[model samples]
Target: MPIKAQMEQLQRVTSLSVALEWVTGCPDLAGRDTVLKLIGEEVSTTIQGVIYSAESKGGGGAEMA
Candidate 1:
């Protein structure tokens, strides 16, 4: 599945193992951790994009304003 679709599906699942199963089709713990970490980094980057965009639009935090 596409990464975005996988992420959306994973977001709906409760258990990490279940999410990983959907991601990789196996119960590979180490690989799952790595994938999860990558997902986290991607999420962090996306959040940063939003924050930067907001700052550029003069909608950032109190300190910036």
Candidate 2:
């Protein structure tokens, strides 16, 4: 997928794991190492963000956006 399209998708997806699973299982995307690597990096970054947000939530009032 093109970067423009990817950016659009990034705005909508709520779960990187599920997106990764879908990408990995995609017939058109099979055997593409670069795409897999990009997906992994995205997932890792997203997970870190979630972890930090959870840990730093103030006054128990913070919720996922």
Which candidate has the top score in TM-score? 1
What local lDDT score does residue 26 receive in model 1, on the 0 to 100 scale?
Answer: 44
Candidate 2 lDDT over residue span 1-65, tens digit each:
34454455555345655666666766764455666787678866755554554556643425544
Model 1 poorest ten-residue lDDT run? 8-17
Clashing pairs in 2: none
Model 2: how far residue 30 lies from native, Å: 10
- lDDT on C-alpha atoms for all candidate structures: 0.58, 0.58
Candidate 1, 12-59: lDDT as tens digits: 443544555566764787886788887666666655655565566565
